[model samples]
Target: MSYIRGYDPDTLREIVDLRECQERLDEIGPQRSLPALLERVWLLKVLGRLDEALVISEQSVRVARMAGTRKDLLRARILHATVLQARGALPAAMQELTTCAEEAEGAEWSGIAAFALQHRGKVSYDAGDYDEARTDFKRALFLRQDAGAADEQLESTLLAIDAADRRRSRTSVAS
Candidate 1:
């Protein structure tokens, strides 16, 4: 079972219940396994605990490097980049995500590549580069569709594309 439970209705944002997250963390209980660390990092990141998330995310990357597969390492790196993005380190986050996306695509890991592209689109959105964000989101949507991703996943990418379009329009109107 994944740690994430649902999405926020108002924004279609991910919603990690605090109580459930804490319980999951406690259940993990000092385990240094990559999955455990990744879950902790995600829970912490969602809880607005970026400092703790960053530490664990880095650790997860290290463990993935030492013990997991290339895919695992890429996943870990992608999560780490998200923590960086959440913490407002856009440049660093973008760099990491860009590398991860390219590497995953090269390996023909369409699902993983789409995941990276989605997050990279998010980073671009955060940086107010709506054109780039929309481009990435479109590519992500294509990849997800090609990989037969779940409906919810496709919805999320579609929503992101819509959001970028809205933002871009708003910006142009203001100019």
Candidate 2:
């Protein structure tokens, strides 16, 4: 199947029935490239089919490894880490994200690096490490701003707020 370029996931979630979209995608799954598979995996993750998403995410990473375009591999790896995080495998997710962030930095891909850092912050937040989460989120905000990524900036801002709230809550409990 040909990749559906510019298929905005946020818009899709607001409009179409993701299940039907996923069903149509599955029907043509065998014909997919790694990019297409990555898209499908994201949809499955949103649908709470974590097991299926993890399987496809792994396959996407494997295929991208063979293909070896740094950007494509970076995207697949990030997605793999995300699925791991969703499945509550925080340590594995953090490890993969750490590696992905390093690779993105080495390649000078600011967008991926920013996104990886943001995801890292999210994992830290999930683990109740609010200080670390706030630190990473701040760094990600800087990167997103430098890259002119307004959408990412907004997300980082919201996450920073959440991290701050979490930190306050934790501190109050300890007091």
Which residue pairs come into collision in candidate 2? Answer: 1-31
* Candidate 1 residue-wise lDDT, 1-175, digit = tens: 5545665432335776788878887888778989889888988888888999999999999999999999999999999999999999999999999999999999999999999999999999888999999999999999999999999899888888988898899899999
Candidate 2, residues 2-70, lDDT tens digits: the string is 222222221111234665767866775765587688887877777778998899999998999898587
**Prediction 2 global C-alpha lDDT:** 0.75
Candidate 2 regions exceeding 4 Å error are: 1-28, 156-163, 166-170
lDDT of 2 at 173: 95
User: What's every prediction's RMSD, in angstroms?
Assistant: 1.8, 5.3
